[model samples]
Target chain A: MAANQEEVKLLGVVGSPFVCRVRIALKFKGIEYEFLEENLANKSDLLLKYNPVHKKVPVFVHNEKPIAESLVIVEYIDETWNNNPILPSDPYQKALARFWSKFIDDKVVGAAWKSAFTVDEKERGKNVQEALEGLQFLEDEIKEKKFFGGEEIGLVDIAGVFIAFWIPIVQEIAGLQLFSSEKFPNLYKWSQELINHSVVKEVLPPREPLFAFFKGRYESLIASQ
Target chain B: MAANQEEVKLLGVVGSPFVCRVRIALKFKGIEYEFLEENLANKSDLLLKYNPVHKKVPVFVHNEKPIAESLVIVEYIDETWNNNPILPSDPYQKALARFWSKFIDDKVVGAAWKSAFTVDEKERGKNVQEALEGLQFLEDEIKEKKFFGGEEIGLVDIAGVFIAFWIPIVQEIAGLQLFSSEKFPNLYKWSQELINHSVVKEVLPPREPLFAFFKGRYESLIASQ
Candidate 1:
């Protein structure tokens, strides 16, 4: 069991891939934190206070300071605790990891989310195509290594996990497959290997509930469009 | 003068903000690395061989392994050499820095660049609005701190120099001033303080040529559109 750090807390909404990232990072570092579930429709005062600009969840409060953004939160967790470092010690390797992490954060998850939300078929297809290009880029980039950081779950792998976990939920909602075994064999295998980790599996909310939640959100968004 | 380390070499293009980031990181860390400039239009065989997929420059070659991405390269430099660690040892503070870094990297610089290049008045306005929003967010976030990392130039500050240096160049090329003292006072002041750093100033290419290059590119892009 991790230490009961009352000084440390995490504010997040359920079913958010971004929040899930922080959860996994905390667990990986064996850092205990209080989890405050936020409502997107009605954000908590703490959430608002912590991330006044974004007003989004996954805000890590430690010793009273609040940190927003999932990847940044994860990096914070790794750095603050001095536990299992998520990034490599080598500068070159770390840069490679950051590159892939940024790529996935921007292209795979970000673009896919946009595509799933867009109503116009043509616009949605363009988003999806760009999302696929991002995936292909991931596939090609990962060719040289087992994991993005090479044989271990680093910053790159954690960031990339958003695509793997959320893609399925998103696919079920969008009624279109973005990443297929045939199209991205390496990524497919790597994702399966990633989620199978005990830490990752433990931190992730039950997929069924997540699927339903995202599905409803996507449908409502599409309907509005 | 830094020692010759055959173990370290940087492959990049001249005048690239991304590549300049790596150069600054190396110089800051007092690490010796040979610089190899690339022609993005006609990429060198080495650039392709190092970063095969994107064929992008700013690939840091260390002990023969290539690492891509500017932010990642910064991390690599911090980790590889223990001197002048760019990130804080504390986990939460590190996350706060990473959060702003990501926010600025993905949003502020991104929107500003788009605003600069966009020909559509409506789209340009939208992009400029977004850029302002991003800057506002940064201004608010940095209110409590001296630097993005607080007190000293750290990872977040380095990651965010994109706005400091490149935005000025973009403003010059686009003939639109989005960041003014009246508009974004803190960011404007922050930019002034940042660019004044010898490392930052030295690493960044002169504005005149960069502006000319981007002006040509933007004009060509608008012409095509």
Candidate 2:
């Protein structure tokens, strides 16, 4: 535990995969932090002040020094606390971890989310195809490992909090079958193992409530478009 | 230098700021390595094999292992050869560097590039405004510091290679005077310092040819759209 753990505070809303990532990292490092839930519709002054550029959350403040962006915060936690090393010690492996984590964000999540929520049929089809292509790359990368971390929950696994928990539910709600156990057995199994992991399990948004929240939000989001 | 200096290979185009970032890092570290100038229109087979995911350049290969993404490769170089420490040693300060570097990519460069290239009058105006707003943040961050690294050319400075050298010519060729020294004196001065810095100056593409290249590319991109 950090000697200044008492000074740590995380400003975020519940059910955001971005927030969940920071939560998981904090838990993994055993750092005690105040969780200030922000209403996204009406963001607090703290949110605006800490993250003036993005003005969004997973803002990790330690001793009043705020660090926004989930991956940056996660790396900071690992470097600061050195308890359970989140990233690999080797430089090459570390770069691979960073690469895969970024690929998840850029390719997997971006395409998958658009596949789910886009109201236009042609766009959604394009998204679904791109999402599947991205997932195929992930599937090949995973091969037989239970996690991208391979026997430990490292940065890539933590960065993949969305794929493990959120995307499946979103896919189900949006009625877009972009991911399936049949299509991607290894990734499917990896997701199950990741969500079931002790550290990740503790921080997961309760599925029932998250599902209900997204159902309402997704419907309204589709309607607005 | 690494014991395997013979094995370090960087595959990228000359004018890309992303490629320039890796070059700056390598030159800063005083690493002697092979530089493969890639034809972006017809990417090499090695490039294809190395970066199948993005199929893009600025792929840093060390000892047969390739790492894609400019920021990721930069971090890898820093960790691999600790000769010149690119990131701040303090955790909080390191996080700030990462945040600002990312902000440069996500906000500053993206908006500035679009501002220059977008053919639509209204879209270009919006991009111009957003680009200036992004530059304003950088202006305040820079203030009176000689560099983001405070007298040292660090990751943020390396990351903003485009701003220092590429974007000015691009903005000029596109006939969009979005960035001006009068409006952003600090940033403009910082950019001047950065471009003239010994490490940065070595790999920068000649301004005349780069202007001609962008002039052609930008004109064609607009016509195609």
Which regions of candidate 1 are displaced past 4 Å? Answer: A83-85, A88-93, A137-154, A221-225, B141-152, B221-225
Per-residue lDDT of A126-209 in model 1, one digit per residue for the tens? 989999999998887777566776666788888877777888778778888888788899988888878887888888888888
What total of clashing residue pairs does each candidate reach? Answer: 4, 0
Per TM-score, the best of the predicted structures is 2
lDDT of 1 at B175: 84
**What is every candidate's C-alpha DockQ against the true complex, given to 2 decimals?**
0.64, 0.94
lDDT of 1 by residue, B1-49 (tens): 2346447889887777788778878877777778887777788898988
TM-score of each: 0.88, 0.97
Global lDDT of each candidate: 0.79, 0.90
lDDT per residue as tens, model 2, A86-189? 99899999999999998888888888888888889999899899889988998899999978888989999998889878889999999888778999999989
